[model samples]
Target: MKLSRHSDYALRIMIQLATSGDALVSIRRIAETYGISHTHLMKIVQSLGRAGFIETVRGRHGGLRLARPAQDISLGALVRHTEGEDGLVDCAGCLIAPACGLPSILAEALEAFLKVLDSYRLSDIASRGRMLRALFDISVPTNP
Candidate 1:
């Protein structure tokens, strides 16, 4: 059950925002911090913004911040929004698929994986705010 890079970036973006609190963070800075391409991060940021997880501001002093509090942003929901609802594998037209339980097993495993993620919010993972801020070399907001 490998998550796509898109989903991975979405999670990273969420964590970055969570650690920053309400402070606006630039995509270019985040890309530089994570060593990802600005173009790729832009795509991910667009997706997240569309999904209402983050808000983007335009113009000279513009940047981005989480749309909602980190405590309200469920990891599972974010993954589902970014990763889509595609099944882990395609059993259609497979030999012996009717008799095979692999599909159900995989489905259950995926459910379990998501269940664990569902139990946490961005704040849960970003609770070590100071550490994360220092790691990213970003100043943590005093009021977060």
Candidate 2:
């Protein structure tokens, strides 16, 4: 299943912050590092912030950081937050909507997909902290 670019960016931002530890990361730097639009990334960041995944600090010295530990952030939870409750198919307009089994089958597929994601925390996916930091030119936590 393909996730929206918005969800994709949110996950990337989370991973970046997870690897940074307590360090505040600038949105501009993250955008540049990922070759993504700053404006686009800003919107994703705002959504993640609203969902309580990340915290925004205001001030000249302020930036963004994870609101909680990486281990507490589940991939399935993040996907749900970003994707909302929209169904995979719009059977409302289909002629066979009343008896079609496609919707139920698709729903089962989605459930299985999310079940796999639910098994992993951000910590599991962000295990390559040093590698990610090096690729982004950010300093890796010596103690991590």
Candidate 3:
């Protein structure tokens, strides 16, 4: 099943945060990097913050960071939070809804899909920190 843009954006946001180390990232910066709507991202940020995935710091030097370590954030959990419990297809209006087995099959497929996601964490995807930072034009201090 195709994931919603909301889920996609949320994941991107998480990855961006994951690769940024301890530095706080601004929503505008993320939006500019992804070429997404700043207003739309604000909503997603609010949702993520409310769900305890990311922490938002307010002020001039303030920005955003993960609420916990990247390894502690499960992709499956993030997807679930962003996508909610909605089924892949809305078979409710179908005439054969009562007898159709598609819903169950889709449910199983979604479970399997999420199971794969569950096996991964934010750190897994953001492991290529140097590459990601370079790609995003983010600069992190190197150890001497």
Candidate 4:
């Protein structure tokens, strides 16, 4: 199944936050880094915040961070939140809607796909924190 741009951005946002450690990341920074629209990224950020995936801080020094640890955030759950309950095929108005076996087949395929994602957590993908930070041009904090 193809993922929406919204889901794609959401995953990117999660990865950014995961790689940042405890630092708060701004929407503008993320938008610029990904070369995506700032306005569009804000909407996605709001959706992720509402879904409890990330937390949004207000006022000066404000930005975004994960609501919980990366290890606790499941990839399948994030995709589900962003993808919604819509099925792969919209057979509602089709003449073969009632007779088609394609819907069931697609549903099974989707389930299998999601099951694979379920096996991974955000931490699993964001394990290369140092490399990700460097790639994003984010400064790595010094240990003192």
Candidate 5:
């Protein structure tokens, strides 16, 4: 399935924070690393904070960090929080809803996808590790 750019950004943000170790990272750094707009990244940060996935700190040292360990954060949770797709297609406005099995099939598939994601956490990603940080040279903040 094709994930939206927003979903990709959310995953990128999570992976970055997971790999950063102990330091808080800024949205600017994340946007730079992923080559995304700072303004868009800010919106993602706000959404994640509202969903309880990440915490925001204030002041000069203020930045972003995972609310919990990487392993504790599930990819499914992140996707749900970020993507929020209930089905493969937009069936709500579809003219035919009762006859089509598309909605049911899509629902099952989506559930299975989530079940697989639920198997892994941010910690798993961290443990296995990825080279996302090097891709953009994102430096973790020392102060926050």
Candidate 6:
């Protein structure tokens, strides 16, 4: 199953913040470090904020931070917050809802997928992110 770019970026932002270890990070730094649009990342941050994954601080010395410990945030929860309740297939309100097996198949797969994701926390991914980035020499933000 392929992931959306938005979800990918959100995970990056999470890891970046988690690795920074108490440093308040700004959108521009994240955007520049990841080579993504600050505009797009800002929207993702806003959604994550709304979902209670991350919190935003205002004013001159303000930025963003995780709302909870990295290990407490589940990937399934993050994706649900980012993508909403619609499963992989949209058969619930589809025209083929009368006869298609798409809904059930998607529901089953989605449940399994979420179960797997739920097994890993933000901390798990953050550690993995550091290793993978280091292996590939990817310039992930390691400090504020």
Candidate number achieving the greatest lDDT relative to the actual structure: 3
Model 3 Cα displacement at 75 (Å)? 0.5
- Candidate 2: list runs displaced more than 4 Å: none
Task: Find the 10 residues in a row with the least total lDDT in model 4.
Answer: 135-144
Q: Score each candidate by Cα lDDT.
A: 0.90, 0.91, 0.94, 0.93, 0.81, 0.80
In candidate 6, stretches whose alpha carbon ends up further than 4 angstroms from where it belongs are 92-96, 128-144
- Determine which window of 10 residues in candidate 5 has minimal summed lDDT: 135-144
Clashing residue pairs in candidate 3 are none
Question: TM-scores for all candidates?
Answer: 0.93, 0.96, 0.95, 0.96, 0.86, 0.82
Tens digits of lDDT, candidate 6, 40-102: 998999988988888889989998888899989998888777666777865547777898887
lDDT of 3 by residue, 1-144 (tens): 788999999999999999998889999999999999999999999999999999999999999999999999999999999999898989877999999998999999999999999999999999988888888889755840
lDDT (10s digit) by residue, model 5, range 12-119: 888888877667898877877768999999998899999988898888988889988887898888888777866778877677887888888988988998899889
Backbone clashes under 3 angstroms, per model:
0, 0, 0, 0, 3, 0
Q: Positional deviation of 48 in candidate 2, in angstroms? A: 0.4
lDDT of 4 by residue, 1-144 (tens): 789999999999999999987899999999999999999999999999999999999988999999999999999999999999788989989999888899999999999989999999999989987788898888976641
Instruction: For residues 1-144, write the lDDT of model 1, one tens digit per residue.
Output: 789999988898889988887789999989998999999999989989988999999987789999999999999999999889877998889999989999999989999999998999999999999889989898756764
Error of 4 at 77 (Å): 0.3
